[model samples]
Target: MQRYELAAVTGLDSLTRVERDVPRPGPGQVLIRTTAWSLNYRDLLVAGGRYGPPRAGCVPLSDGVGVIEEVGAGVTRVAVGDRVAGIFMQGWIAGDIPGDAGNTALGGAIDGMLSEYVVLSAEGVVKVPAHLTDAEAASLPCAAVTAWNALVRESGIRAGDTVVLLGTGGVSLIALQFAKLHGATTIVTSSSDAKLDIARRLGADHTVNYRAQPDWDRAVLDITNGRGADIVVEVGGPGTFDKSLAALRPGGHLPLIGVLTGVNGAVSTAAILRKHIRVHGIYVGSREMFDEMNRAIAASGLRPPVDRNFGFDDARAAYEHLERAAHAGKVTLTR
Candidate 1:
């Protein structure tokens, strides 16, 4: 088997490719031949030593789709030849997140999917949607699931309600699709007018250039006729959290999902108390959530956009591209 390992917490150069013997699946485990993988902003943080120090010699990527090559004893959930993707947290099957969930997270806590072959617990893998390509399915485990958990599972967004998305990253774009699928009006914010135009074509009811309008939250209030958005996908942590609170209607929902900005910042408990807002901290969800999301994706025929595809040998380049933050959607690597 061939794999890329993080030799050190340095930069893209830390990801080194090497060969090793493929390991067989244990009881209740499944071995898969990885076909495609996707990069996330978290991957960049891990590689750059910003997300926390990863284990030495860890395979670095959480999202991938592949074909099952073999199944171990007691594995009945899937069979050989089934196409599947591993859940972000192997231990989190349903309901509340368990205490050991962090230990089971791919890329950071354990060896991930950036390899020619990988073994995962059968319970931790979900069948990919039939209509999506391998690259598209590979994009789902982290980014798409976070978006689904925020809008569908946590917020319970409904028709005619307004939803605000913070940026044109993978999670935000997928949130736009999910919001529109549920009949909610979508408002997307981006620094580039070109990206805002693209968001409009993708069903965004309103677009705001945060660079042009520094107080973009005011724009959100105006668009919603002073009532404010019913739901806000708050991906920008401290830098934009206050504005996100101001842009939400009283008793609205704000699912805090990302820390693209710095981790620590001023938070207004007064506004939260005064407005009677509900703010939920979102992590990538469980396998059951992944299954439900796949069903909705299949029904809606929603294909996640792949901003660029790179060959397996160009893995380092792919990381650099994601670091540049120039992509409009998910970036993928194919074997």
Candidate 2:
């Protein structure tokens, strides 16, 4: 079997391909023949040693879709030939996230799906929506699940509510789709007009270019006739936090999902208090959430956008492309 591993967490150059024996399933595990993989911003952080030092020589990707080749003793959740995607946190099967969930995360805490084959707990995999292609299914495990967890699960978003999205990244684009799916009025912001046009085609009701309109919060207010948005999908960190707050209605919800901007800076607690806003920090999601999300996706026949695809051998170039941050949707690799 062929696999890519990080020789060291220096950068994309650290990813090196090597030969390995195809792994067999252990008790309660399933052996998967990985077919496709997707990249997220977190992958960049992990590759650059910014998401904490990953285990030496570990495969470096959390999102992938594959077929079950075999199942271990007592395993019954899925069978051979089942197409499935591994959940981000293998330990977080249901309910709230466990304290040790971080230890079970793929790519960082464990060998991930960047290999031709992988063995994971039978309980950790979910069936892929039949309508989705391999690359689209692979894109769901992290970014799509996080978007569902934020807008659907956490915010309880409903029809007629105004939802604000930070940018046209994976999560934001997916959030735009979900918010529109639920009949919400969607507002999207980007630095690029071309991306905003894409967002509009994806059902964004209004768009803002933060570069042209530095006070985008005021733009949000103007769009909503000063009532403000009911929910803000806050992906930008400290740099946009204040604006996110300013753009929200009193008692609005903000699901803080990413730190695309710098991670730390001063924030105004007074603004939060004054607005009575609820800020929820979203990690990816539990397996149960993934299941619910898959059901919704399958029923709606919604396809996630694939910005680009690379051959398996071009994995390093894929990483570099993500680092450049020009792609509007998920970047994927196919075997």
Tens-digit lDDT track of model 2 for 262-300: 889899999999999999989899999999999999999
Q: Which residues of candidate 2, in runs, are more than 4 Å off?
A: none
Model 1 weakest lDDT span, ten residues long: 47-56
RMSD of 2: 0.9
- TM-score per candidate, in order? 0.99, 0.98
- For candidate 1, report its TM-score: 0.99
Runs with alpha carbons beyond 4 Å of true place in candidate 1: none
Clashes of each: 0, 0
Give the top-scoring candidate (lDDT). 1
lDDT of 2: 0.92
Tens-digit lDDT string for candidate 1 (94-177): 999898888889999888999999999999899999999999999999999999999999999899889999989999998899
